[model samples]
Target: MASGCEKGEKVQVGKSDLEEKILETATELFAEHGYVKASVRDIAKLVKGSNSCLYVCFKNKDEILFRIITDVGSDLLNELNKVISKHDDPVECLQDMIFTQILFSIGAAKKMKIYLEEQYQLPPSLKEKALDQHRQLYDLYYNKICEIEKQGLLYQKIDKVVMTFGIFSNINWVYRWLNPIGRLSVEEVALQITDMLLRSVLKNSPLST
Candidate 1:
């Protein structure tokens, strides 16, 4: 009798809450005192776990850093996919992407800071792989923008590469100054940014109106 198990299905095993706490502590430590300066002992101590426990979860500091980067990237890509899949209209898709990204940035500001500022501190091979992951993300935005243009929604013909870069620059860097405890909530800020970007690109959406 043939069972129902498939060959290519991916099984996602959830991590323990304690392990999640360890990663959270590590993110704070790395952000506070650069990735290279933050030691595994510091992370273990803050997580209230022994060095051996960290070793059980991660091989070394390098593995921890890679894991943090990989985890955040995976989440962002998954969310981006969801936003992309939900909308048939490219303009709405990009707006949702911007809003979702802002919410992600606000919620994971510390992790975002560490991911952006600490990439070079990773080992050479690891750094290369991490950067390649980043490039893949960039390509996603580029392709999305290109698809939008193909629909003739853009008012003018602009360079796709430069436009993609511009869009990322216009949105992603907000992590540097966004305040979670500030006057505006994450949803509010995301709405404003989404409006700003959508008005910039959509032919029917004007900035002044």
Candidate 2:
């Protein structure tokens, strides 16, 4: 019943505290063992609840996976839209988009991992719903690229889809390498990536100014 939770963090959709705990534990297990390998019993064991308790909240493992993916995708879109609304300058918008996404991905690295990796395991109907969320996220970046192109700052030679996915390729896997407690803070890593990405796609790197 929670509409949304925190920015750059897992959004809680579970109705009860126990439901939230199941979601948290399930995300860790799914990210670690994959959706197919991780079972309802595995999740229930981790939550110290019976499988029936899990069934009470979620009909099946697929439902839990669907909820996690939906919540993460929705939270990410909300954060990205906020960045888009906050910045009038296309260059700045693009820069913050990179930062915001990287920040969110790292913060919810496990859920993002499950989202990127295991979402295909979902049944067709649920998969399409999840894919719709992904497409919206994709368009936010694609449209921002168009904005930059309109400003005559984007490098026109690169296909916009390629440009958008290139940025995605750069940021999407940050969860694999980023060390949350390592020398660099999350913001620092996000900024470094933003600078690197902007330098490649923009005619004039905004960081230069």
> To one decimal, what is the Cα RMSD in angstroms of model 2 from the true structure?
6.6
Runs in model 1 deviating more than 4 A are 1-18, 204-208
User: Where does the lowest 10-residue lDDT sum fall in candidate 2?
Assistant: 2-11
> Which window of 10 residues has the lowest lDDT sum in candidate 1?
1-10
TM-score of 2: 0.89
Prediction-by-prediction clash tally: 0, 0
lDDT of 1: 0.76
Cα error of candidate 2 at position 209, Å? 5.8
Q: What tens digits encode model 2's per-residue C-alpha lDDT throughout 5-104?
A: 3334353555477678888999999988889999888887777666776776788898999999999999999999999999999898888889988989
lDDT of each: 0.76, 0.87
Q: What tens digits encode model 1's per-residue C-alpha lDDT throughout 121-199?
A: 7899988888888888898787778777888877575577777777777677888877878899868877887887777
- List residue ranges in candidate 2 displaced over 4 A: 1-15
